[model samples]
Target: MVVGGDAAKEYVAGFAAGVATVIVGHPFDTIKVKLQTHNTKTQVKEYKNAIHCTSQILRSEGVKGLYRGASSSFIGMAFESSLIFGIYSQAKQLLQGETESIKPQLQVIIPSAAFGGALISFILCPAELVKCRMQVQGRDSANSNYVRYAGPLDCALNTMKSEGVKGIFRGGFTTLLRESIGNATFFSTYEMSRHYMHLQLNSNSSARSQQSKILSDVGIGIISGGLAGMAFWTAVLPLDVAKTLIQTAPDPNSSRDPFRTLGSIYSRVGLKGCYAGLGPTLARAFPANAVAIVTWEGAAKLLGVKRD
Candidate 1:
């Protein structure tokens, strides 16, 4: 019997990971969103690059500008992470069957992770829609097109009222593609990295103290998690750019298909346009996901959750 833990505890572990992700990643995410949607509602680009965007936000709106939509992100991430981790763990278990001690095959890992990512899209689309909309509403007095909402709740309600429920989920398709592909890459990379790291560590465990072993586990988690995050964004950042465009378009009726949106962006600004926020995104991906996985593993251990 898998006596240490069950599937439900995965949700609790996931919730901790989600909170950690937002705290470390939200600022970078804000900058990424801003850079991606810089010209959405205006004729001129407000930011030349991530550095310029960050400096401008600090100058004009202070640090708060970078956290505009974090409220929604918190709620979204908490629920999103819980569902994703829980679903992925459950799926992986079912797929692995009685081979609990064996390494997970790529076939099982990718499909199980992708399934979790796909389902989370329904939740992520709306949460990100609100987050993007809020992030783009800058304090630039020159840009008169900004639609300022009182808060995330206001943004959600207004979107619901104006565009119906579909408005809240404006970038559903793009989000689905991004999440599914990104998560498959994420879990696979993490698993592979951790597997190798564990092999290296186990060979030396007899020579190390218990405290040293704990520290080594944390170090491994950070490296594996950071690598997983970078891999995820590298694979699906173009889709994320399209999703931002769709979500933050001034016109709610803009094309929602990610491919169509990408084509339009490519025609206008070439490849750079398709990867507008790559810098900040990659920068944020490492530490944010590092913390997330560490927190997740810690929480799982605390909750007595079992893992193969």
Candidate 2:
């Protein structure tokens, strides 16, 4: 039935795209999470950089270590991406109205994207909390000193049992902030870039060159998507660091108020702590997001998503 109509097709497209995207980018995500939550006060930091981190994981935990917490990511992305892309398309359309403008206005896109981000943050919070905690486990002497969850499901279940439902929403405020700001920048950048590219590439082309135009659009999508991805990460990296710390904190009994988590990060490591994993996060942004946005766009096109 989902394949029987446009709305269904959109859902299916987003679901499939999310699955493919997590596969392509999960290792990079793992590294980024580990880096973000790394405590500098430890006897020694777990890794010096992305390279050393990858090397250590491979040498110590094997390839599986690189994929730690991926199951949670898959579950998170499946729901988060579907909700975000689906809601964003609907919201953008409402903003665009029945006028059928030739192109989307920035005013229409910015708020729509922000709303979508805000909506998905609630869904993303719990899954992301489990994912980050699982990813960073075993690295710490405390976790090494005790038992860890069997997997993401176990982590979520245990968290719920011990701390109730609200425990899963750790860092929810920061997640909301990060998603809203990042996604606003992300969608706006992508739209503006793609529009400019269209103007440049299609200005002189004719009907006979349609294929070339399509190819050009694909190329433009990659670049624009990369730019959008980078903008999102760079704008929200500090908040993201705080979110990771709150989500991965060993003590669920401890408060995870956004201001408190932020203050803790600053107090312990100063400004640099908030940007701890910036290098790896930026490195992951380009290729991973380029691929995700392209795949999402390509899938949406096939499913007739025009506004987003």
Predicted model with the maximum TM-score:
1
Model 1 TM-score is: 0.95
lDDT of 2 by residue, 173-196 (tens): 899998999999988988888788
Task: Name every residue pair that clashes in candidate 1.
Answer: none
**Candidate 2 residue runs with Cα over 4 Å from true position:** 1-5, 40-44, 139-147, 207-210, 304-308
Error of 1 at 140 (Å): 4.4
lDDT of model 1 at residue 7?
Answer: 77
Clashes of 1: 0
lDDT of 2 at 132: 86
